[model samples]
Target: MTRKVPLANYLFTRLRQLGVGAVHGVPGDYTLRALDYLQPAGLRWIGSCNELNAGYAADGYARVKGISALFTTYGVGELSAINAVMGSYAEFSPVVHIVGTAPRNAYTSRAMVHHSLGDGNLRIFADMYAKVTAAQANLIDVKTAPETIDQTLEQCMVQSRPVYIELPSDMVAAQVPEVRLSVPLNVSPPKNTDEAEDHVVSAVLSRIYASKKPYILVDGLVAPDGIVDEVSEFARITGFPTFALTFGGGIIRGDLENFHGVHAGKFGTLDFTSYTDTADLALLFGPLLSDTNTLGWSTVPKKEITISLRRTAIELGPSSHNLHIKSFMQKLITRLDSSRLSARKPTPSLSSPRDLIKNLPEIDPSAAIDQDTFYLRISSFFRAGDIVICANGTPLVGGRDFVLPVGARLINSSIFLSVGHMLPAAQGIALVQCELAESGHTPGRTIFFEGDGSFQASAQELSTIIRYRLDVTIFIINNEGYAYERHIHGMDEEYNDVAPWRYLEAPSFFGAPTNGSYKIELHDVKTWGELDKVIKNAGFQDGKGLKMVNVRMGRDDVSTNFKAALQLAGRQLMADAK
Candidate 1:
């Protein structure tokens, strides 16, 4: 142990122990000291062009690494990153946010504070995120720093959401507090064999058994929680068709007989919607059911047995209920007496609507797969612990709905919901994975799927990818426009149109070393025949270089089969209006 360690060192060490191998962000006033210390502590400091992108980079890293961190200066930094932090909240990807501020005493004085952004500048990020974070602090109460940090990590790692911990500039040099790093990371989900686990399991199981139409739905609990296999076991035990309401993927695989598909918003599957809500017993495991994913709230089962692995304190009412997700899953698996499971309605053949859209003069392959199938296919690409970096626009369709392979992540502006988050997020995630790879830890990959509109936002990250020499496979869905915007505004031209860029030239323009930098490959497909080659390419798994595939489709076509979706939403809104 080195002597005279700074307060920042303690925070960094704490994070290092929690499996955070990298930190993402552009160093600012508050975070400069810690950023410097990070280099010496064997941490990779990844940079993005802006703080928002920095936060997004960190969020993506968190998705794959199980836990991730970002450091920035005060106010401006914190505010910019808020969207990404919230995105992580929406996806339930656990990430640690460290923002630098002045010493608590510095703000205590009444001297108009020369250093802040216009108006109230004292507490800064603390107030903005106190409600959403697991814990937060600065250096003033140096003694409590350790406790605060520990609790914050515990909360973030266990709950699998974004948490904020503000560190003052002076705190970076403060003395270390009393906290042992070798506490043996016991992150096992809530353990209970008897009343706790068994009771909850029996309740859910009995309900499912009684109701002719019961379904299993899960969310963020799968990743950052190390319980995907266990959840799969539980699903196998009960023969109820499963579908997730809040999607960060991995609740169920399309190949799996149990998984029906994720249904949400204007992009949800009408078939799945018709089958699931009609049930009497609806099990919501490790899910929030956020507003964006209302999933026809007016139509959801009147009764729901909600299960959360770390729902110690939640706000709920009479119509809904809760359960400790881990214990509930464990007990459910234990109680099953053989009798493997089966799907409710033989998961009908997955016929794509690509034909209808393709028949039109122009339809992008990237937008070819409906939200559900797109998510299903993307989920097929990775497993637990692999990072799935999502770009804005079309890519998030896969992020929000894809059934992740437990521990697989959904990285973007978690809640911030910004569009250009993908590449920057992947940069941070890859840097960490590269470090971990060097340390001989787990062999994992960082994959990013960029949208035409969103890719342009952080296209510079291709250079960053080559600068650090990371083996990140980026799949740029060259749809050449902002597809989602069209749906939102009644499919108008202006909302969906954008200046088309040579998607494959990004790496070449950035001077990726001839041999060192991965080659940026382009694929402009006009027909399904051409798309097959893009999807079947062996290069995706190797992840050797910056391979950019320009997928071209018919532009005159409006293949998005949102008719049923719009109809349902209209009906539901009308119902709620009454």
Candidate 2:
């Protein structure tokens, strides 16, 4: 006789097999019964304060763990979290969105449910999800449920995007065959035809060998596409100059001799821009050329001389080929003849963030901490194995200038540009770090750089972080309002301002223990002297459960690179005014 398990049990077990250790979401009426199967399936249920934060947390967890799961009730709950799911789709984070809905009887009878639109349209929410999710399945039959679940999850993994599943309340306890669980889901993409693969490889190598000044640009999608190692190895073996866009920063090893920092297009130094402009050939990996990622398209390479390698296709100038990036890269690397490639010397004039920091002149300690020197000064605080997250607004802009250590990962909103994403994302990242530490891996601290205005949007999540006692260090740039918005359009507009709060008291207010094995530290710094002392303290350097630092800066002051973009926007607005 074949063994069987409940539908919810089978679903949660598959998620566990996919390496999702925790399910992030809020407890809702429709999902309450299904939640009972999580722990039995070896998964933890993290009850978030709201569905939106839960969605953001799931996205963050997926970034660290490769895949994650989120639970939400029907219409209201799912709709609230839709924006976050859209962000995951835009950025290629794999998230399993399992939504619990009313019983099959309600759908068959066309009954109006509490969460529904009152017009008996039960499918509206699922219809909306179909637009953003890679795949969707309504599990109504036990016999077909297992196969459907596996297929949808496979799509989520292969595509590296969100997928949706509708679990009827009555089906939660329905029995399903356990035999299918014995076979692991296969998520590998289809192999390219040998003839097609060979043509693309030959084309790439021919250009690479013939070019005098060749450069490699790694973009944000490389990580989600699982090609970071391959791309890094290619760049390493070639000994070619390589640079990452803002979204791709820290994915490649930063200590490489030929590794330049982030290329910010028009905002970059003249020497750096001049070097890239003179390249005879350019190779792009997982290129995501959004306006914000490319600094208003200023960093895009000349199309005539560029070759872009995507997950499913390869673009060579005007021609396109159906080829898998991973398979093609493997073949190209094996066929590379290093001796045939042109040799070029490294440009000494291009200065990295570390070089700029080292050459800085001493300043008055009593002087207020300004945006021009803040990110550079804080660069020394980062260490290897740190997972640094920057929220949208000023943090994202200034964080591009960080000189990350080897093994560090920098995460920011490259396309979604959500304002309050990093704080809860830090929570998810820190939870994974703790889980890794318990499993005998060297755990890293979750460092978050947030804007004052953005922090208020999801401040309740801080209490959840304190309850879990995750190791997270938060640096809040208190510029009194949305300084990033101020620079873009309004210099002193009331709409750009945020209400002031007692920022340093957040730890206690969030219920961090006053005395325990885990300690909480809070500091308010206004001047360069105060900031310097806080960073150098032994307690602050040690990765603790909860640490908060409030650094005050001028509202109009922004990073130099960001200031350039803002000035252009200001001029555009002025032109519109006339």
| Candidate 1 structure quality by residue, lDDT tens digits, 49-135 | 677887777877777678899777777778887877877776777879888877667687633444465465576557878766655
TM-score of each: 0.81, 0.97
Residue 414 displacement in candidate 2 (angstroms): 1.2
Residue 223's lDDT in candidate 1: 51
In order, what lDDT does every prediction score? 0.62, 0.88
Q: Residue-wise lDDT of candidate 2 within 1-578, one digit each (tens)?
A: 98999999999999999998999999888999999999999999888889999999999999999999999999999998999999999999999999999999999888988999889889999999999999999999878999999999999999999999999999999999999899999988779999989988999999998999888898989998888899988988887888888889888887777787788876753236787888888898888898888888888899998999989889999999988788888899999999998845565766677677788778678999988778878888989889999999888878777888888999887889887887888888888898898889998789999999999998889988988878989999999998887888877899999999998788788787877767888899889999999989988988787889999998787877668888897787799999
* Model 2 segments more than 4 A misplaced: 269-271, 573-578
Alpha carbon lDDT at 402, candidate 2: 84
Task: Name the 10 consecutive residues with the lowest summed lDDT in model 1.
Answer: 350-359
Steric clash pairs (candidate 2)? none
